[model samples]
Target: MSPRIGYFLSCEEYSPSQLIEQAKLAERAGFEALWISDHFHPWNDAQGNSAYVWGMIGAISQACSLPITTAVTCPILRQHPAIVAQAAATAKVLTNGRFTLGIGTGEALNEHVLGQRWPNTDVRLSMLGEAVDVMRQLWTGESVTHHGDHYTVEDARIYTLPDEPVKVYVSAFGPKALEVAARIGDGLCSTMPEADVVSSFKEKAGPGKPAQVGYKVSYSTDPERALDYAHELWFNEGIPGEAAQVLSSPKHFEQLAPLVTRDAVAGSTVHEADVDKHVAEFAKYADAGYDEVFIADMGPEYEGFFRFYEKDVLPRIRG
Candidate 1:
């Protein structure tokens, strides 16, 4: 197999029943896994989102029969790793071993709200490494009292932990984080499947570890509409600078926020051009040896989008 194919769902916006419907359609359409997003808010301006993730996950478990994981979540700053561990344990029991904990250092937008300190880039990565260490220890179904540099625990045990350790997939962007992932992670998770980054990560990240990538784009009947939506959300995702680096800094996003104006996000997508364009975009990641690719779209035309993909993209790409 050339690696699994997957998609993202917006549990926040969709009603519980609506989420079930789409998840069933996605699984039946042959997507191997479902990677969903977790957010306390939906960007700025309230975007009309921000649903409860735990409840949504519970509903998803009952409604669909496919593997699932958070594309990436920050368990450290906002929520205690203990809570995350408990939730993951319950979800694992519910899903029968179909969930993986995809974790990251976290962004300030979600982490800073609790009045907890949000460290700089390097420090945040350090906290993440410690958090993972702590989470794994707690998940062992043993009483743990970890006293680490960033996090500490006392006589903690999770009897509900699944029979085995939950695979911890670390999300990294640059060199340092990748090294952390290599040191502790069972798998690699990133949104950018850039070949050089993957190669660099694998090089320093060590051997025998698999790499996974996730990316997003919009779908529309008109090329311009698609590009517009894409740019609105993504131009910053590609905004030619250390955005590649400074995601840890809340100010970086605020500074770059102006560039991904309504126009930029809207005008940068490539829908209605060619299905090959979408396939080729994803194929580049597959070509880079990503063990899996999870893609999401942000428009209402996903039914039509998947129809086009199934008829035109999946046959050729899945081969």
Candidate 2:
């Protein structure tokens, strides 16, 4: 069976109004759901904009009927897990239970604003594990008092909540994080089309758990323009390794952006208007066993992007 296809909203690139517009467009374009990025800062200043994701979610809930998930929020830092729990619960109520909280260990790019010491990978993962435990306890509508290794919550309870606990989809990129996702996540969230990742998650999470993956494409009638947008707006995507996870500022990313070549970006993304290529990209994730695949169009060609997908790409994929 074909996996459900959704649209990804890039909060780092678009304003609140634009994000909400894309949410409505995705619904109208026959996309099954929405994945909105949660970031405190853009990877580079060129992609400028980082609205608080909770506020965006509330606004988006009123504007569109499609379900929404934070592409991945870091509840471990920047926001307390208890606060994240309340916000997520309110979001679930606002969306009439269509809101899912997608969480991860997070990056210093967003979490360093508070000037807290950046922990190592093992420590961050441990914090994330504890944070998820704190959130889940609060979601039960009982007063929660948690004093764990990384977080402390005192008699906190979420008053506004949906009938069901907000579903959590954990985002994982490495083996350790994947293990946590399998153990705690109601679903798995990822950006890569890796069959082994999905199979491992399903094996550990057991039957009936869903896995979602998202990626970006730059669509334009002029293929060169598409390539240009991908390179100009998202060269950070080409940055190697843990730089993305450890970089503390957008300037640091901008400084390294020059090292990323257009060809590198081209090799990684579908930066063209070709419907066949677009369909094939989604198929890669579906074939990898993702239950859902989300695509984000980079730059200002989103209107054309939606039209192209709705008319040409989606039907072909569904057929």
RMSD of each: 3.0, 0.8
Mind giving the per-residue lDDT tens digits that candidate 2 earns over 29-82? 999999999999998898989989999999999999899999899998788899
lDDT of 1 by residue, 85-147 (tens): 888888777778888878887666667778776678888888888888788888878898988
Worst 10 residues of 2 by lDDT: 152-161
Candidate 2 stretches with Cα past 4 Å from truth are none
Best by TM-score: 2
